[model samples]
Target: MRFRPSPATVAVASLLCLLVGLVYLAMQIRTVFSDQLKQEYAGLVLETVERAESARDQVRVWQQLPVDHPADASGYRTARAELARRLASLDALMNASPSAVPQVMSSALSADANLTDTDNLLSNASSYWRAQRDANSADVRVRTIHIARTLIALAALLFCMLVTAVGMYAKRNRLLAGQSFEFERASLHDPMTGLPNRRKLLAALEEAAATPAHQASIQKIAVLYIDLDGFKQVNDSLGHRAGDEFLIAVSVRFRESVRKADVVARIGGDEFAVLIRTFSTEEELADIARRLIACVANTDAQMGIGHVRASIGIASFPDLVDDYRRLVAAADDAMYHVKRSGKNGYAFVTAAGRSAVS
Candidate 1:
C-alpha cells in the first residue's frame, strides 16, 4: 500500500515550507539590491582614480615647464585649476571608502603644499582606490555565488511543495471516492484496543438493517453483549495500568475468536459488544460464545490477573427482538442476568416462554 500522510500533517508541513522559503527569498533579494549599490560605488571610485592619475601627469608637466619662459604664468594657472578639479573629484570618491583615503590625501597635500612633490600623494590615493575597487569586486563575486545557491535551494523547495500539493490532491480524490476513510474510522474506533467503538457498532447495525434481503448475503443478525468478570478487582489489586493492559489482551483474544466480517466493539469500560453478521445455526452462535469465553478464561493466568472471565448475553434479530434497535438492549439485559446468577457464563434472551438457544 502507498503511504499517505494525514491532512493535518500535510498542512503543517506546507505552512512551514512556505514560511521558510518566503523569509529566505526576501533576504536574498535584499542582498542582491545591496550588491548593485556596491557595484555603482566601485565604478565611481575607479573614475576618481583615473582623474587623480591625470592630475599627477599635469603636475609633472608643470614642473618640467621652463621657469623663466614667457608662457610660464599662463601654464602655471591652468595646471593649478586642473589639479583643484581632480582633488574635488577625489573628495567625492572618498565618501565611498571613507576616513582613511581622505585623511591620508589631506595630510599629503598639506606636506607638499608648494606642489613641488605630489607623485607620492597621487600614488597613495591611486593605491587606496584600487584596493577599494578590488574589495568591492570580490564581495560582488561572493554574493553572486551565494545568491545563485539560494535560488537553487528555493527552486528545490518549490518542487517539493509541488509534489506535496499533488499528493494532497490524490489523497482528497481517494477520500471522495470512498477508497479511504481513515479519519472517519479513527473517530469511530477505540484508541486503546483499535476496535470499533459503540458508535461504529450501532452504525454497522443500522446499515445491516437497511440492506434489502435480496441484496444481503446473510439475512440474520445477532449481538453479543459481554461484561468482564473480576475486572474491577484486577484494577483494584494490580493498579489501573495493569487493568488497561489486561483489557487490551482480552480484546485481542476476543477479536481472534470472531470471524473477519464480525465486529468486536468496546462499548464501555470492562464491557464489550460483538456483532455476528452471519451464522447458520444456534449451535454455531453458542460455539462462538464458548470460544469467546475460553479466550478470556485462558488469558487470566498468562496476564497474572487470576481468573477473569466473560459474562455474555446473546440477542438475535427476528427471534428474540422484533426491532433491530432493541438488539443491543436485549443483549445487555441478558448479560446482566448472567452477571446476577453467577458470572462467567453466557445466556440468550427469552421470548414467548422459550429461551433462544444458548
Candidate 2:
C-alpha cells in the first residue's frame, strides 16, 4: 500500500506556504518602494548639481565682463548670491538623503568650500563643481544598478513563491475546494492600475524566453520602454491628486492601445513597459509605437494636462538580444537617447543598428 499524507497535514502545509508567500511579498513590495525613494533622492541630487553648474557658469560669464562696468558688477553680485543659495540647498539635500554616498558628500563639501573661497572662486570652483557633478552622476548609476538587481531578485523569488503556492493548492484541492485564489492573483498585479506589475511582467518575459512553443512560433519579442515627458511639471503644477488622475487615465489608454496578447505594465512612476511576443517586421513595431505615443498625447490633452508626450525605446529579442535584463536595458538606453536628443519620440535598439522615429 502507498503511504499518503493526512488531510490535516496538507492543511497545515498549505497554510504555512500561504503565510510565507504573503510575508515575502510584503518584504519585496517594501524594498521596491525603498528603491524608488532612493532613485527619487538621486534625481533631486542630480537636479541640484545642474542648478549649481548653471549658477557657476553664470558667475564665470559675469566675471569675464568688464570689472568696472556697473551693470556687469550688479549681475555678478546677483549670480554669486544665487550660487551661494544653490550650494546651501545642495548641502541641505545631502543631509536629508538617507543613503547619501560618501564620495558624493566629500565632493559636495569640497565644491562648497571652493565656491565660497573668494581667492579660489575663479581658479578652482569650476573644477570642484565638475567633480561634484561627476561623482553624483556615478552615484546615480550605481543606485540604478542596485535597484535593477533588487528587482530581478524579487521577481525570481516571487516566481518561486508562485510555484510553491500552486503546488500546494493542487495538493489540497479537495480539502480547499471552492476557495478563492483571488489573493494570489492580486499580489501579482498593480493595485492602482489593475494591470500586471513589474514582477508579473518579468515573469512573463522569462516564460516566453523559456517556452519551446514561443521559440518556434514567435518571430520576435519586442520590449518597449515608455516614459511620459513633462509629467513632473504637470504633477507639480496640478497637484498630486491631479497627477494620480493623470496616471490612471494614461494607464487606461495604455491598455486600450495594446493588443490583447501584448503585456502592458507600469514599471515605475510615469514609466511603462510593453512586451510584444509576436511581430513580423520592424514596421509592425514602429506602427505600434506610434499608436501608443498618439494615445498618450491625446489622453494628456483630453485630461487637461498640457501636451504631455511619450518617449519610447524598443528592443527586440533574439534578433537584437537574447537575455531579458539586457533586452530591457537596451530599451532603457534607447529611451534615454530619445530623451537626450528630444522628447516625444521613439527609437529602436538592435544588434545591427539603432534608429529614431519622431
- Model 1 lDDT per residue over 213-293, tens place: 577443678999999998899988889999889889989999999989899999979999999986777678788889989
Over 1-358, each residue of candidate 2 has an lDDT whose tens digit, in order, gives 9978775575576567656656665665566566556656666676776787788888879878898878887888888788777766766776676663433334333423455453343234345545655665566566556656666665666676668667777868844553445665677777878778888888888776665753555356889999999999887898988888888888898888878989998887899989997788888988988998988888888987776899999998877776655777788888998999887999988576565545
Candidate 2 steric clashes:
0
The true-versus-predicted C-alpha distance at residue 135 of model 2, in Å, is 99
Consecutive 10-residue window with the lowest summed lDDT within model 2:
102-111
How well does each candidate superpose onto the true structure, as a TM-score? 0.52, 0.48
Which ten contiguous residues of candidate 1 have the minimum total lDDT? Answer: 103-112
lDDT, candidates in the order shown = 0.78, 0.74
Candidate topping lDDT: 1
Once model 1 is optimally superposed onto the true structure by TM-score, how far is the C-alpha of residue 268 displaced, in angstroms?
1.2
